[model samples]
Target: MHRLEQQFIDNQWVRSRGARYLPVMNPYREEVLAEVTAGAPQDVDDAVKTAQRALPAWRSLGGAKRATYLEGFAAALTRRREALVRLSSTNNGKVLAEAAIDLDDAIACYRYYADQARRLDERQGAAVSVEMANVEARCYHDPVGVVGLITPWNFPLVTSAWKLAPALAAGCTAVLKPSEVTPLPEQALAEIALEIGLPSGVLNLLNGDGEGIGAPLSRHAGIDKISFTGSNRVGEAVMAAAAERTVGVSLELGGKSPILVMEDADPEQAADWVMAGIYFNAGQICSATSRLLVHEAVADSLYSALEKRIDALVLGNPLAEQTDMGPLANARQRETVNGYLATAEQEGLRVVRDARHRQLPSRGYFVAPTLYRDVPLTSRLWKEEIFGPVLCGHSVANEQEAIALANDSDFGLAATVISGDGDRARRIGRELRAGSIWFNSEQLVLPETGWGGFKRSGIGRELGPWGLSSYLEVKHVIGPSHG
Candidate 1:
């Protein structure tokens, strides 16, 4: 039984004032891995104040100095790569390969931001050419200051890295609230900071649920920005709370992204990509392609191939090297997925695969990958974001029908077009109302590209230069030229 019951505040591991403790469970084993302090509003205040105090000095260090710290953080992560992979797999119930990939992505993200930070002031800045004579105007990019980073449990370290690395790169101090389910990795990052002798109060971490810490952090006046990645409902609450102080907020919310398979696409290839998209990370990804719009000519063949590929998936311990899929992150998530399964059954959708046909470990929260076809357009199975390893497929007669069906949803986070014809794929990709679109392939997010959505999916991007901009405040400095 691991007991890690403390919050990292002002560069110190301090015991919480609150008495409650939240258990961090190994989702695959359904056992308590560790217990973390359930921080209260006072703890949130402490973290925010610490971050606020540290901001001025951190920003004054400028981009070059900040880059060195970020590079140090990246090196620290590299040294702890193996431990981080094991922790992520055990705590989050992701396959070992996925966990390793998550760490690698985080390391790359930090390094990318380190490079960006080194060149932030040099490569990018605004020096306007004014129309009026003897008038010289320039703009400066300044840190947003004391940002409150709230990341979800799905991809704990990677998501937090997206916010933290960029915030640090932009020369901002932050108070991070990792999900109560998986706060270990974020805490581990703080531990590395401590080991590297990072300045006090530059990066603080508070661990708690939404009610205990999230609300207070969002509404805190000392927090100049709130960068959040979670459910849309909570994101709305964060936005509303931040409105109280007019604080800057960047949210990467929920998604019900879809993929379109053209008639020209190979059924086998389409099946493989679609399976990977929906089942990777157990379909917990916000940009997951959960909805598939297939051309009628190839729908039957593609669906059959997908069923065969999905059946070949191995589900077991995340630590096991051969396990292709692991359990849901927690029992609650299993229940939620089961609820959706029941709804799909009631709606009379064609269930291609589910847990009823498979044997799973009785001890943990496990849900078999499911594929539903001929789903009603109005059913929740088609509209709601299940956020589990479930796919809802629809058949479209032509390209026009496919595009229309794909764009019918309230979400526009991501869409993919699979076609043999590159020209046709490019044309269709342009018509999809999503932030990210792929042609003939689907994989993980690239750090250099922007990642966000339209409509209810999300408000702002979270990676690349766009992500760095989210943590910065731009100001126009106008003065008379004494030439």
Candidate 2:
């Protein structure tokens, strides 16, 4: 068992102000694998003060120096990738393969931002001609002081890397409050940051739930910006809390993303994409394609392929090399998903797949993958975000119908289009109201591309240069020029 009994503050692993502790459980085993200090509002205040104290020095260190630190940090991640993967699997309950991807993505993100940081000086100031003869204008991107970053339980370290990397690269000091349910991975990350010699107060980690740290962090006057990733419910609270200070906030909220399978698409490939989109990580992912909008002509063939694919999946211990999927991260998540399933049944949706249909272990927070077809537009299964290994399928009469159903969600985080014709797929992708769209493929978030959503999915982007901009405040300098 692991015990992360201290929070990282002011470059030290210090005991929390509160004596309470939270147990970190392995959802696959349904047992406590570790314990972390449960930080309180005072802890948030201290971390914020420390980060605020360190911001000026860290930002003055110049982008190039920050780039060097990041590159070194990426190297450190490579050296410890396997350990991180195992910790992630144990703490977050994702399969080994998925956990590995989290570590790999974190490494790639840090490297990508390291390069961006190096070019920060070049990208900063842009000279512009002024209407007044004696005046000259230029714009610069400055660091957004102390930032409070709240990451979710799913993809703990990778999500932290998405926010923390850019925040640091943009020359901002940070106080990261990772999900209390999955604090182990973030603890390891904080250790790595200290090992790499990140300056004192540059990066502080506070382990706690929303009341303990998230709410307080968002409202802290010392925090100049707030970056959060989680359910839309909490994201709303974060926004409201930050409003007290009117601090800059970036939110990557919930999504009910859809996968549109065209009649001309290969049935086998389409089914594979659909399964991966929802069943991977047991459907806890924010951008999980929970809704499957397919052409009526090909729905049967695709469902047949999906049934075969689902039966072959290996659902077991996350540590096993052969395990294709793991349990939900916690019991609360499992109950929430089961509640949605019950609602789906009550709403008269046809169940295409169910847990009883497959052979599986009876322990842990395991909800076998499920699919519901002929789901009406008004059904909760179709309208609400179940956030489980459950897919709500709808048959569309034509391409236009499919597009309409796909864009029906309040969320516009992500959408996938599968079509044999490249131009046709591109045309459909263009029309989808989502931040990220996949054409003739499945969901894949690259480090260089922006990832966020439209409408209620989120307020701002989280990856690429767009992510860096979240931690920066632009300034226009106007003065007399002798040129």
Candidate 3:
């Protein structure tokens, strides 16, 4: 078994001060995959202080130079792509194909932010027009300073990249606390940072549970900013911590996103998109479109197609090439999801499909892809973020009803609109109250697009220019027109 007992601090892999060690498991085999260090509150202090110390030099290094370092990170990721992909799959219980997609997205994020970093140089101190003739103004984007980056277990390296790339590109040093449940894949990031000669303490990686590292890091006074991607419960805690210090905070939280399929759409094609929406990454995606709102005229055909597709999914070892779906990240996740399933049974929800209909692996934390039709509007399964391959759906009378159902959610992270007519799909998509909307397509997220939603879904956006901006503070400078 792999033993990762050291935390990356000040560019060195040092044994953690905390005596606790958490076992990292391979969900598919129900075996211990690795033992990672659980960092102590002291470790958080050391990491945050180190990052605070390194901030000045790193920030003053200039955006063009930061872009070069970001490019180096991209290059290092490229060289270690295959190994990282396998590690991510093994640690996170996602299929190899999905793990590869995560790595690719990570690599692309670094490269994309590298370009943005270069542009920052040109944008710095750019002239701003003013109505008053005598006064000239310029705007400057400055680094927000030392930041604490906490990522969830589901996406592993992908979420790390989403936060880290932009934070670094914006010239901020960071202390990253990846989830203790699946920390193996994230270890590569620290290795790459050191290999690429990132300034000592510019990037500190601590492996631990929320209590051990995340809590301390979020509350650390040295941290000038906090960016977190996880559940709403933790996001609120982080926000409260940031409030104490009045520091900048960016949170990407939970979702019970919707997928609206119009009657005009082809059932077969819509089924594929629906499967990809809720089944990809075993529906661990925060932006998973788990609440399906189908047009009443086509509900029967769409449900039939979805049942067939769900049954066809290969549930086994994530490392296998043919495995379309893998076990949940860990036993706790499985238990949490199973609790929801049990509740659904108690509520007497119309279970269209579930694990009862499939023969799962002999040993694994697997949850068969589930579908519930005609679910009550008030059911927990219909409103809560299950974070599993559980799709709760019902029929809507028409496009208006579909749009109304889609918008009726506490979480507005994302939505999918499917229709034969592109114009109709786009028009309907425009009405959904989600941050990311897809029209006649699978759930495609790129580094160029912004992420994070309205209301309780999240506090700030990530990816694209918005991500880089999160780690930056803007300043306005005014002077005489001819100065």
Q: What is the C-alpha lDDT of each candidate?
A: 0.88, 0.89, 0.91
Q: What is the lDDT of residue 141 in candidate 3?
A: 97
Kindly provide the TM-score of model 2 when superposed on the true structure, using C-alpha atoms: 0.98
> What is the C-alpha local distance difference test score of candidate 2?
0.89
Model 2 CA deviation exceeding 4 Å by range: none
For model 3 the local lDDT of residue 306 reads 91
Under the 3 Å rule for N, CA and C atoms, how many clashes does model 1 have? 0
Worst 10-residue lDDT window for candidate 3 reads: 351-360
Output the better candidate (1/3) by lDDT.
Answer: 3
Instruction: Show model 3 residue runs off by greater than 4 Å.
Output: none
Clash number for each model: 0, 0, 0
Distance from true position, residue 434, model 3, in Å?
0.9
